[model samples]
Target: MYKKLFLSCIFSLLAICPILANGELDSCESEVKRLCQNQTESIKKTLACLKKNHKSLSIQCRKEIERGVKQEVQTKPPTGMLFSGGGGLGGRFSFIPLIKYQGENFGPLGSDDEDKKTRLRRQSVEGSTPIGKIGGGFISTSVRYGVTRFKEDQFLNNGTKVNDKLEQLELGINFNRPLENKKNINIRAQYGYRGDRIGGSDYNYSLMTGYSHPTESGRGRWQYFLMFSNNGPLGSNIPIPGVMYFYRTSTMNLLLGLPVLSFQWTPENTLFSLSLSTFGPFYNLEVNYGLVDQVQYFIFSRWKQENFFLSERRFEEDRLNLYEKVSGVGMRSALMKSSVGLELRAGYSSDRKLYLGDGLFNNDRGSLDLSDTLFLKLMLTKAFR
Candidate 1:
């Protein structure tokens, strides 16, 4: 009887080991634990646990893991997607969809693949601006930071750690003057630089010109703007048009814009804002919790993201791809012109192969594959009217 049980365990190991090695086992962690909770003695128990819980697994988790078991597995792109260039920061506030920037992956390739060789890492900042508008559109300035804390601990085939850190900074300014004082119309021009270090202009730069006009609508007011940048991520930065109507009443604020749209409901000292556009969805809320000195130091929280780029290619008859994505969340003191706070972010990279499978998510994010990135963001902005 013992011999028979041992043979059953052996067969089970044969079925599960490859999937576990591929890193597709995370989704089923809880299921695995519950099924094999007390079976720590040997492989036999763990194998039985997983098999028993097979029916309860997530479709994605089961599909990826089982794909490896078959001999006729469909090919996937090379592991590791990489990207380089500039203007990636311009998409910062865009709500429109765009062709994401794509490149070769750096650092280690697939987390499961053998012969781990080349390693890569990076870091940077996002949306940091100082000194807001002056006399309508006099000087609009901003500063942002970023970083790639590459996985240095992972070694390569030759045992050499290729751990490296990349830091980036972006500084931008816009100058403007009123075209007509009575109409509240202003002409604006902008210049910006993105660099590897802090000195500025290591890789990217931008120049643009535009106009802003506020006019009377049927029952309210309308704010209008039109501009073109020279080095935008979308080719040569063509004409981008936007409009806005900012009106506030007793219990609510109506904010409508062609390029950017948002709605806010402020009842008493509490505020709630909801926004959705070409980019994605954004939600925020602020309330005076008296967390400070009770000076109406309203506490605010926000959820937003910047989808950098994603692309697919064919190499040596095999598919290749790259993905760049950024997500952020923060808490700050509510100020109409300036606000300061802390944000957290995550990103990833790979070297050897392209992400071939359909990916855990969809192409809406540029690529479904991302890994090994963690960092904190410092944000500060000041607006001058």
Candidate 2:
């Protein structure tokens, strides 16, 4: 099975590089002992003497050290279940390597209709781990693999074949527990697979269970859930019900329920930062800036969708869908002091699509419309913070 899912994503990236966690300086412990108390010989020399005395600290320890150095150079290490994907809460371990391209276009179903340019490429890898205290709750797992390619020939008006190549794999797990009215209860699950060679391959799953509570004057909390997925979109594949409300302090974090909505903010000795999200099937917006403290620069926009299941179907309840919208600009660095990182992005993609559906009730047998393009990405990372 693809070499056991590539050796289970390299054994969850070598088991989460020894339990990563070196980036939560206890909310700036008293401004790091009132400013690098002897630089404690580590934690990167107390974060380089608190960014060299970041204007002497205080305002809640300089907004938690500028929101942890802008999420240590713009975060990106998720493959589901970091608090059920809605603004992750804590836990670490990562390994990323990606490459993407989108060039060549000429959509609106080219070939003979003219403009037959078609192109797309992708390569991916992801990992995650942290499976500690089991029964008492606290476990994690993740794995992913992607391989996409679509070039040349693009047919589909019943002639099927819309440029082949597609292979995906995923696995996830999550769990949390804590009660006694202190609130917390979680459970998550995921499984996915999709191979392809013109139309064949399937396996899917998703689930969630939540409970959060808190809020008796603790900044925020209150989440509830029950979800299901079979790659959604047709009566949303059953089990559904949700609620949310997260809100944290010291530099913000917010989330508002049903069909989730998330937000993030960072100020106080800032150099810009912002975020937005509508979890699950993705919808994002980001902005960041802080060209130092390990570099960062970003601006993003996204909307995504994916669904696949096609055991050779020429129509009758077919499925294979993909849609995307993009906008981008990116830069992230942090290799010099190493946790190993790098990122870059370029964009412009619009109302893309590829189809054959049954999840929105019998979608026509073929559809392809992908043009307005120009995409690029490159990433390399090894993180645990």
Each prediction's TM-score versus the true structure: 0.40, 0.32
Q: What is the overall TM-score of model 1 with all chains considered together?
A: 0.40
lDDT of 2: 0.54
Residue lDDT tens for model 2, 1-385: 1111111111111111111122223455545555667865554455455435545655554444444333322222122223343112222222122122222222333344344345576676766655556676556666666766676656666677754566667676666665554566767776776546422355666777877776777666687877676665433356778787766677776667766576768776766778666655556777877632356788898776556665666653466776778887987654433445566778777877777866552447777776666777876655433
Total colliding residue pairs, candidate 2? 0
What C-alpha lDDT values do all the predictions have? 0.31, 0.54
Candidate 2 regions with alpha-carbon error over 4 angstroms: 1-113, 116-157, 160-214, 225-237, 243-245, 254-263, 276-278, 281-283, 288-298, 306-322, 329-347, 358-369, 372-385
Q: Pick the candidate with the highest lDDT.
A: 2
Per-residue lDDT of model 1, residues 163-185, tens digit only:
23334345544343444422334
Off by over 4 Å in 1: 1-137, 140-145, 152-167, 179-182, 185-203, 207-210, 213-219, 229-236, 269-330, 334-368, 371-385
Clashing residue pairs, backbone N/CA/C < 3 A, model 2: none
